[model samples]
Structure formats: C-alpha cells, structure tokens
Target: MSLLSDPTRLAGLVTREVRTGSRDGVPTRIAVARRSYQTDPADLWDALTNPERIPRWFLPISGRLEVGGRYQLEGHANGVIERCDAPKALAATWEWDGKVSWMEVGLTPVNDGTQLELTHEVPFEPEMWGRFGPGAVGVGWDLTLAGLGSYLSSGEAVDPKEGQHVHRTPEGRVFIRASVTGWGEAAIADGDEPATAQTAADAAYSFYTTEPDSRPES
Candidate 1:
C-alpha cells in the first residue's frame, strides 16, 4: 500500500499522479503536472534552469545546467544534470548519500497557460518515508509550485519565513488542513483501513502543527 494513508501527510496544494514503477528491487514511481503561472515555455524554462532566476522564486541553486554537468543548491545536496532541453524539459540526479534521486521538470504550452510537470523518482524506503508521512514531501512541493506560480505571475517571491506566514494565515491554514484530509481519503483509497488512516492522520497533523520550540518530556 502507498505510505500516504494519513490526512496530514497528504497536505500538498498540488499532486497529480502520473505513473508508478519498480527497478532492481527498488520502488520507483512518477507524478506529473505541478503549478506554474507562466504560459510561455521559454519563460518557464528560464525560471527553472537559470540559477539567478531560480532563487528569485524557488530555493537558491548554483550549478551548470548543461547535460552531465554537476550542480547544487545552497542548502541542498549536489547532483548531476541528466538531461537538458531548452524551453521544454530538464532532468537531473538529486544527490543523497552517494545515491541519486531522479527529478524531471517538463513544460507544455496549453490553452490558458503553460502546464508545468515535475516528476521525482527516488528509492522508496517505507521506514524512512513513513516517518514524515505523505505530507512531508507533498506540502513541500505545493509550496514550491506556489512560489513558482507567484514569481511567474507577479515577479514576487513567496518567502514563508519573511514575516508573511502563509501557512499560518486562515486561507493557507484551511488549504493545508483540507489537503491533510484529502491525504487521509487517499490513504483509504490506497487500501489502508479507514480507522487506521484516520488515526494516523491526527497524529501526523499534531506533529506538523506543534511549535518547533516546544520541548517534550526529557
């Protein structure tokens, strides 16, 4: 069963399932189509590949974007560029522990705007992944997509730490709460018992909402 059985785990703003697979005893899967407001493929591509433009919307990144070139985010691990196609597609190896996770971003021009798709394929280890719940990865992607969309639309950066606590605002909090519930439903749909998923969802939400500075029993 998918490890996203908890509602709190599923709290990302956008997550579209694309495909799932397994390779060499490692489980690998894909999800595509995230958020981006820019309708022009070239614009979207620049926002993603240009290191200078990336930090304006997403996290700070420093790297050579050419194929087979290595790159790194200021606070993220370094990885090699696996594919690079101007105004259309980009893929790379996301480095972690001498191993690499696969990530791809695709841009497609649509009627209203450009559709941005992000696919990530990593070795799924239930023990580690389950600890954070599905929302761990999902919410992060949602925030990333939102940042990209905002940047493309108004050239504004969505800095969560910049005294504008989006996650704490009423709208932001509601969206997050609903996303957690949706994840709970998804968990049940994925074959987990309803009661178990619900219980896990509550626990996950508490973990996320708790103040980071609060201390537990020693």
Candidate 2:
C-alpha cells in the first residue's frame, strides 16, 4: 500500500478527548489530542522548546519562550507564555485573529518513549463548531505530530508543501475523512448532538482535504 493508503504509516495516531469546561462564565470545550512518540521525554521536550530546532520540524518560532513572556510561530498565532516548565509541560495563550485561546502541552515518560498530550481550550461558538468539530484542530496537530515523527526518527525535515500536496489527493481524503469522523464521535461523547456533530465533521473533512483553500491562512 502507498504511504497515504497505509493506515499504520500516515493515518491519525492521535487519540482524542473532549471535555466540557467553562471559561470566563462562558461554556467552553477542551479538546485533548494524545499520542506517543518514539523518542525520550528530554529529546521530545527539546524538539518542542528549543527555538533553534523547532523550525526544523514545526515552524520557525521567535519569542522569549519564558514564563510571562511572548512568542510567535511564523505566520501563525502569537501569544504570551502563560507557563513553562522544563521537559514536562508548557502552557500558552494562542492569540490569533484578535481572539485568544488556551493551549497546553504535557509530556510524560512512558516506557522508553514519551507520550505527548496537547489540550486546546476554546469558548464554544456554535457557528464555528458547526463548521468543524475538534478535528479542525485535531488534524492540524496530527500533521505536526507526523512531521515531528519524521524528524525524530530520520533527522529529516518534512516539506510542508509536499506533505500538503499528498493531503490534497484522493488517498489523503480517506485519511482526513476518518480523522473528522473520529473527532465527531469524540465530540458526541462530550455531549454534542449526534446529527449536528456529523454534519460539522463532514464540513471539517471537506475543509481540510480541499486544495489551496484547505491550507492555513497566514
């Protein structure tokens, strides 16, 4: 099977959880995506926090990268570093498009490798939720995780353009659709309506797999 067709190779390795929570008196939801990587906690943490190395796998980051400091991820979100702890956990404010969200990454030592769990919390906006379930974020994390895996295992940088090209093909659509469905079920388990979540999942799948428009806006 092609790499895209093989479920074990490029498919969603992240397990998801949706938790009902409250933020600033507004009912919100926290979507948690968890996955294990074939690297030790220290190496994984360094790959994540080290400014010099992050650009190799993820995006170029420029910021203080300290507690109560500020950070920017390339042409993406810029936020303050709410909390930072070495080789364990980090939390930050994800400020983009004039809105703010919370993001946290926790690392755990499991056997020989490390387990990474990313939790993103946002205020529940029905319209946005109608457009996509957690997969909108979940799939993005999956992409990052895939890149991290490639880098950690082979010491090679994943071409974002080439990776995206594959994700735009038919085989990529199959993987994306499965990711959306998985997130939809996760949302339902967190108390979302069945039909509504499915509709949003379909929209999310289409939004991610479509060429050009599917890519994240700068």
Candidate 3:
C-alpha cells in the first residue's frame, strides 16, 4: 500500500510524545514516537540494522554498526553505537555539526506485528525550541517511519530525493501538517503554553513545506 495514498492516516499511525529530563545536571527534552509495522520484530530489526538495507528506507549508512563502534549516515549525523541488543533494543549517540544527542530504538511484539519506539534526547535550547519546537526532530522521524513502512510493504527502495522533498507534494503536505500538529500537541502536553507551542509548530510547518527556491523575502 502506498503511504501517500492516505497520507493523513499514515501520519496518524505514529504516536508522539514529549518529556523533560536532566543529563548530568543539564536540562534536556526528549521526543518519543511510536509506530507499528505489519512485519514481525525480527524483520523490522533487520530493516533497521542491516547496513545493506538501510538506504532502502533511511539514509545510506557507513561504518561499523555494533556496540562501541561509530557509524555515519550519508551527508547526515555520525555517532557511536553505545548499546545493541539484537531485534529488541539499540541505543546510539547522534552527533552532527558539533552537537551531540542521544537516540534509542526499541522493538516490541504486538499482536502479530512489531511496535517500534524511537526516542531522541537533546539538550534543551530555549532559542531553538522556541523557534522550531519538537517538530524539528519529530517530523523527520515521522518521515523516516513512513519511508520504512513504504519500503517494507513493497521491498523496494525509496527515492531519496523524492522522500526529502515529499512535503512539496499534495499528500506529502498533508502528512507533514499532521505530523507537525501532532508534535505541537505533544509539546503542549509536556507543559508548554498552547500559544507558544502553536507558534513553534507554525515555524516547523513552514520549514518543511516551503520549497527551497520559493522562500518569501524577509
């Protein structure tokens, strides 16, 4: 089934949440998203950990994938694999552009399918949060989950370019809007003022939906 066929429904498949935490006395925010796939845990784990298959859904990954090893995502983040428990849980550092964050993925069996939960923890930046909110990272993961779903359904690779600019398409726009709204609601649930969260969501929505060459003059 094409994810774009029912973009809203596809976006709704994932549940998003936000939480606050402290890392070594520094405040942080965590964004969590959960989505279920029709495939079993083993298959989903293969799709996530197999270097040969990663580019089929997510970015092209290089370097070792085992615990204590470093891996790089093509043109994106590179980090150390801190923990790895096959077909169940994985944790890693997500570092890019001189900043570091933590990420964990857990897979659980659920009614003949698998539930994948992704949690991203980053030090809270007031400016960045006020500017983009959790949608900054949440929506990207939402897209990744959707791509994984598409790939698993057909066993075909997703075109990276099309996936990157999907928000420009009608269905893609709908998907992105729904994702942004979900993140905004999650932020509110995490104690952010509704107006503030909505403002941040608006910024995130524009960031994803605007075409590179079509930016309005400031």
Candidate 4:
C-alpha cells in the first residue's frame, strides 16, 4: 500500500465532527485547513477580491462580490454572496434548490503567514452523512489551500492538468493520493464505517480529477 494510505498521517492533518440539530435545525459542520503559505492578510485579500487574480489561485469566480450579489462559477453552484469584507472574510449561501448549504472563508494574519479558515455547513441527514462524512469536503479544501499557497508564494498557478498527469510521480502523486486517503480516514474517524469512508474518498477523488466538460453521469 502507498504511504499515503497510512491512516495516522491522514488523521494528523484533519479534524472531524458530527453535530445534532438545534432548534433552528442546523446540524452538520465541516472545516479543513493547511499551513505554509505565510499568506499575509493583505495579500490573501487581494487573491480573493482582485478579479484578474482570483483564477490564478482559486476557481474562476464571476459576480459582483458584495453582500446579496448573485455569483456563479461556470460549472459550479450559483449562489448569492452572503457577506463580504474587503480582504478578511467572505460567506455565501451555497444551494441547489431546497438543498441549502453555506460556506465561509476567513483569513487571520499571523507573524509568518496567514491562517485560512474554511467552514462549510450543510443540513445533516443520516444518508448523506454516511456518504460524505467530513473528509469528503476536507480533502478537497486541502488541495485548494495548497494551490492558494503556491499561487501566493510563486505567482503561478499549479496547473491541475499537470498535477493530475504527473500524479504517479513521487511528489505529485503523494500529495494527491495522501489527500484522498487522509479524507477517507477523517470520515472514518468521524464515525463512518471504514468501507464507507474508503468508497467516499474514491468517488470524490474521481469526481475532482475528471474533466469538467466530461463529467460522469450521476
């Protein structure tokens, strides 16, 4: 088995939790993180606010990024920006019909770098929880954070195609494979069965790596 498959390594990088709904019916919560960018708050703010610069690091986002302005990614969900502050924070209601969800990204300046915090909240259901757990989203965030680091430090995007193609190489593959496996372990640690977590990780990795234009049938 690959070293990336090591359960301990995966667990070290993620934290998992399951919440029971309160009166408002809010239940599940998922958060993920990575360190090393040393992304100062000001620089991190630019990466998020500057339209020309957003795509180089994160997904190409198009929309008026003010509170209540509608936004869409070419192939991702269409949602309204729920909150925005120049370079420190953002939040949006992430939805697909009645399936309402929410995401928030915050930056805290540190002495050496910035700390990025991402929180995604979705209504919890037993079936969906079994399928996604926390790591499903956790691992994806890990990769995105890593990309952000590279972009901030080098002013160059880590080509997803190149990253996927050289996935078999020592560095590239290790990153991808470990991220996938780490997510699976996090899910299991959060109460999902081992087999279920593995399946979720496999499916998520496949979904992320597949070309956007050639998505597999749901």
Q: Identify the leading candidate in terms of lDDT.
A: 3
Candidate 3 on 73-110: residue-level lDDT in tens?
99999999999999899999999889999999999999
Which consecutive 10 residues in model 2 have the weakest lDDT in total? 1-10
Clash pairs for candidate 1: 7-180, 7-184, 9-135
lDDT of 1 by residue, 169-193 (tens): 5555555566555555555665546
What overall lDDT, based on C-alpha atoms, would model 2 receive against the true structure? Answer: 0.81
* Candidate 4 wrongly placed segments (more than 4 Å): 1-23, 34-36, 96-99, 160-173, 188-195, 206-218
In model 2, state the lDDT of residue 91. 96
In model 4, the worst 10-residue window by lDDT is 1-10
TM-score order of candidates, best first?
3, 2, 1, 4
Provide the lDDT at 79 for model 3.
Answer: 99
Model 2 scores a TM of 0.90
lDDT of model 1, residue 146: 62
User: Every model's Cα RMSD, please?
Assistant: 6.5, 2.8, 1.9, 5.1
lDDT by residue for model 4 (87-125), tens: 778899876645767788777777878766777776666
Pairs in clash, predicted candidate 3: none
lDDT of each: 0.61, 0.81, 0.92, 0.63
Please identify model 2 stretches exceeding 4 Å from their true place: 1-9, 212-218
- Candidate 1 deviant stretches above 4 angstroms: 1-15, 29-33, 36-38, 96-99, 163-171, 182-218
Error of 1 at 69 (Å): 1.5
